[model samples]
Target chain A: MGQTTAEKIFAAHLRDEPFPGTKVIDIDRVLCHEITTPVAIADLEARGKDRVFDNTKIKAVIDHVTPAKDSKTALQAKMLRDWAHRHDIKDFFDVGRNGVCHAIFPEKGYIRPGFTVIMGDSHTCTHGAFGAFAAGIGTTDLEVGMLKGVCAFREPKTIRINLNGKLPAGVYAKDAILFVIGQIGVNGATDRVIEFHGSVVEAMSMESRMTLCNMAIEAGGTSGICQPDAVTVDYLWPFISGEFASKKAALTEYGKWCADADAAYEKVLDFDMSQIGPQVTYGYKPDCVKPVAEMVGTPVDQVYIGSCTNGRLEDLRIAAKILKGKKIVDSVRGIVSPATPQVFQDALKEGIIDIFMQAGFCVTNPTCGACLGMSNGVLSDGEVCASTTNRNFAGRMGKGGMVHLMSPATAAATALAGSIALAKP
Target chain B: MKKIFGGPVLCLDRSDINTDEIIPAKYLTEVTKEALKPYILEDLSLDGFDAKGAPLKNAQVIVTRGNFGCGSSREHAPWVFEVNNIHTIIAESYARIFRQNMFNCGMLAIELPKAQIDTLVDMAKGGALVVSVDLPAQRISATADGREESFSFELSPFDKALVEAGGWVEFADARY
Candidate 1:
């Protein structure tokens, strides 16, 4: 039988020889955020477990409700900070230290090829861009992972997505993935390992690939990964302070790195990126997507470009290039949040932040603000906003507010026209 | 696991019933799990669904066509159902994380074909439907209109054990 990518990762981590149904494999890294950490700790304490099993391997970040949204969220963040401190966990990232769990880990080199990672946040699958076997778990499941430094999962089937040809002008990785979801529907890739191949994925930047893998959850995919290439190597070089050879060696040693020629997939999806367009969701779900031309001139109240999904440096660069020296229309409220502290600093050094500010945009700190409707920039009743975030579920930005999901370029264009507009550059 | 006789399998009969439809993101920050009860199904566009807040009142079983829980892997979707007296859910299929969330919370989710679900919904329409889910036997039997019908499903041994032990946390409590 042809082993899937998940099986290969599991086989490598298993204590015994791997013929997998379920095994409590060793976890290399585990991630928790403020919302989940409190619940996990409360569960652990109730069960008489006083400490995390492996504090060094665990990282806690306070991003979602960071800068403390309310008194309750503030208390939870403080509790997590104190607990992480008590554990002497060196990787613990407080509000200012870490930006977003998914983005910052890769920025700091915590996620690399061949590693098995699990985070309390579903977007943890974002690390799959680096060939990491990452998945999301519930608060209680996180407790189990913390208790034993491992968690068991049913080996999943694999789905191969081949992206051939080149994307059209103004189209991006976000549009491609959104096109995949639109065709397959939300649950089309349910519980499967979605592996990307062919020329289009090969051409995407590490940041763009992260955007693609991050939304695999939107299509009910467990993990979405692409084979590492020169782009990945280049991205990791700065993180490792320069380890080109070692990174290549580690990835190669993680045998069964790619699917075999004869490997069988439960489903195979092919996309000619030429057919894709600058995409945006019309309604609540991420799969409710349409092209920019179709959605043009749909009025918007606010436009946000950030999140673990599309808040990286490249995303800001593209949006900034379009919005340079042009003031955001008087009606639209433009906001951009760079994904990580590194991305924020890089954007600042590159004058991207200044361009955004000059366009009358609010360039905020690296927090998942207003993405999940918890913190600042929240929408009011019956308001609609253009967002670069992943999920646009009902009441995502605020109570009775609607979100239209789009890429940073489209979002910037929306700021210019005060409606759903496509990027021209 | 104990045999559960779930009252009136409320046929939502929709595809892609996402977590947001179950509970929106606004109420996600509210304290206490019980606070979700009023907000449950508050955003779904179901016919006759009261937007002012109409929860699944006495319905113990929720039957859907396919993809019962799709977008967003919020475990609270299942947790909210478990808290609001939802014991068993019969669906044609479920998204990955949502199904696992259901099992971990001991809110039983069983897969039945849309054809079988159509039959079950038809039977439900005939009169009051009493759906009995046998966790160990992996069978769901429905009694309605003075007739009884049963269908078989499958569950992994580990998930069955979790169901038998009530929930994952409880199972963890016993073992660890």
Candidate 2:
């Protein structure tokens, strides 16, 4: 009877009586966003349900299509805002206040270590940096989670992605994740729990760890998590209330929740971080990745830098460093949207904003915008664009548009040159 | 009204074909289903473009490694693949959500044993290989090698009806 990290977290957060691992365990946290919530609200209205299960526990945000570019998006935002007001969802983070859901969540204390957080977006695993069991759900299940504060899930078998040694400089967590995806292919870890550990992980910052966990969905994992430590405590301390004693007690309770030393796992993958380099996805899938040096010489018509995947402040700083003196290629269309207002402000204070503007790029406000093909920087027919955002499915940025997924560094380099570089070295 | 899916298997050897690769995050909009067809298999093909004057045309069956359809719970995923003529998929595994989406959309995701996948990939080197997916028997057979394989699946009443109707949208339309 061995329990894994996720199993332990799930047990701690079980809403009702616990059962065997075979049963579909109901989740504790239910989060939603603009694109997915409107329909859920409509479903709730149709069902004649007036109130949500628990206003305090449930969360909603306006990350998608906010600063509404057009009437449709503005209308969509309004609809989401109105729904949140109507439901009295206390944890709702609206536009101006909202950043990327994954980044802003832990900051606001909506996600605590050892808690189970479920959202309607794929990168819910970003909360896993705090040792929480965070996973994504669909619209219908989101509707159910809104009403019941629970969504059903089975216990996933675990896979240990162990890293050794230090990552090479400029080879960030995004590259590490892309490298793993390249090795395992997409869907390599479906219905599986992914727990990242090792010397490399321990050496990485909490933010970097979040970036890795954020893309666990690409591996078909239910949830991905890193164990909590001092960095986790420091990251979370800002959002807690009451005296330090109360918060420390809660944190201690969380510390005890990590998977016991003898917990079972189905598979283990060991990789040396020293072998990884700056990588980018050449084609539509995140797993369609290659080393930066090897990926050069591909032509590009557009370049974008934004998304929940790599749209953080650090991502912007990295891109800004690359683009400061270099001008965007005249033939290429470059769009830079920050992940959040906080990121946007940080970039502004750091002069990253000026560099981007000087480079002849369009810097849109924070939103899910181009990441989901709704707004800014969509591709025209037969168009090819390199983007920092995750995914490159055709018509993803725009109909008839060809997408190449990459890191902000790669995206910036592509924008400057108007072609995928053969080598940034 | 039991339906049959007949299409040659254009086997894909790689594993873990994520949903983001199936349909990128950018295309989650567009209320209409018809708009998604061109993007099908856009990443896997060499042209580095979606369908429309591409080399690989009318590819029906896809063979891949485990956990096909990972990332983001987008229903539009299976809809795009189903409309694109990807009738049957032989994979070593599948993501839970993506597998459920495929089933709901009436696509047969046959999980073959890994050893058989190797033989199937070899057979597909020259051209398309014919793989028969018998839903009633829950068995997948590769005609080139003449090997029968078993797949683990649980077809809900809703999915069974959709598969019986030939496709999901058709079943959805029929219900209306």
Candidate 3:
């Protein structure tokens, strides 16, 4: 029988096709971060599972708490490192090489195209950039994936997001995504694969494409996918050069990466970028976004310009320009976190870090820190903080804290005003 | 294993009520099942939330709109309902990830009709009302002032077994 792109991918990965509707596909990649794995390992040890099914296939990275910054947090990071070394996990990116779990794994080639990826972190959907089917699993599920290469899953419906026209100046990929979330609301794509196509997406850089797929989980999609185009081939060819060469030699491969034109989808959403503007999430949710011009001076208690979502070099450049020669409002605690140590170094080389520090922004090391309220940057009771992270549920950054998600530019501007401020030209 | 369904539900029609909203993310640090009770629905009170807020109060089941749990993989999402006396949550739809998480933890997430959602919302705005859900009948009978409406849902054998087992822990315990 003919099948959709989703069915084709599933069938290729199916180890035990339990039934027509419910199939158990072999997981291609498994990712675990410091926070979730420690307890999970403890649970496994309790369960008497002495050895993992395959350590090479497992990638554990330390990212949640880093640069230690304090004695307690330093101990946490050390514990995670010790566990990784003890387990013989092949890919362990410590503090220096560590980054947000989703960003680091794909960059390292642990997540490949047309493969099934599962991670303990919720944003595992970020790997869908390479046309992979990735999803977040709980600790129990992670335990299962570690013990066995396959994970039981019910196939989800696919959603086609067609994009056309070039993005307007100042309206970056993050805004386009926030605009999509606003239209669809948070749960619009529940249990579905979101495929981006048409001209606009074709024009995006690989880094920007990663940004787009990274936020798919914000609107509750199972994963976000962009087909393997030239950008994908170029970005992946570096790390997987040998694998790509060998795979190319064999024309007929079981797991080919391409989206069929007539692939079935539960819904199709069209986004015209010419009409979009720089978006800032107003109240709390990612979908609660409006153009930056309309959101300035809304009053905020904090401004955070970082997270896996927008802590890249380009994001810092934008933020630094807004913050240069200016001071963060006394009431607001301004924070800047580079996505990786390399990003931090690059920002320093570009004088972006100097600009940020001069503006009274506290610079944090690469980790999913303040984004999840784990470390020092957490918000206080009823405090409204503008952040560049994905989620904005109440107290996401701390107890009773209010998080307003926004672009890095907007966050920097908000830092200057001690409120939600638009990035003025 | 104990049976948790076949009880009356108190419907909440809010959509996209995220994990943080269900039981503020801070409470998730507790590492124990019993600690989840205090934070459930902490965001819903007419008075702005105090950390000491009681969950679900005297509620049984909750009925809500589409995409009820849409963000974060914090286990607190389902633990909120289980600890707060919410036996089943009937929504028009639910977030895929949250639904799977809830299912794994032994929660009965039933999808019901949207018309009843409006009625439930109206009743909630006025005060409290009773919603009866019968898993065996595959119908939810919503009751208020001599009026009873029945809504239908599709259930798999796995879910039926889960409902019969009361929840995930009990089901696992029974199996082991």
Q: Pick the candidate with the highest DockQ.
A: 1
User: Which DockQ values do the candidates obtain, in the order shown?
Assistant: 0.46, 0.22, 0.33
Which number leads on TM-score? 1
By DockQ, the candidates rank as 1, 3, 2
Q: Which lDDT values do the candidates have, in the order given? A: 0.80, 0.71, 0.72
Judging by lDDT, tell me the better candidate of 1 and 2: 1
Residue pairs with backbone atoms closer than 3 Å in model 1 (clashes): none
Q: Native contacts recovered by candidate 2, as a share?
A: 0.36
- For model 3 the local lDDT of residue A22 reads 56
| Models ranked on lDDT | 1, 3, 2
Q: Which structure is stronger by DockQ: 1 or 3?
A: 1
Pick the lDDT winner: 1
Model 2 lDDT tens row, A359-416: 9899987777777677777677888888777666546677677777777877888888
| Model 1 residue A417 CA deviation in Å | 1.1
Q: For candidate 2, lDDT tens digit of each residue in B1-176?
A: 23236456666566556666676655445333566777765554332334454323655677777667766687667767766777677787777776655654566766667887787777766555676666777656665545433444444455565467654334433332
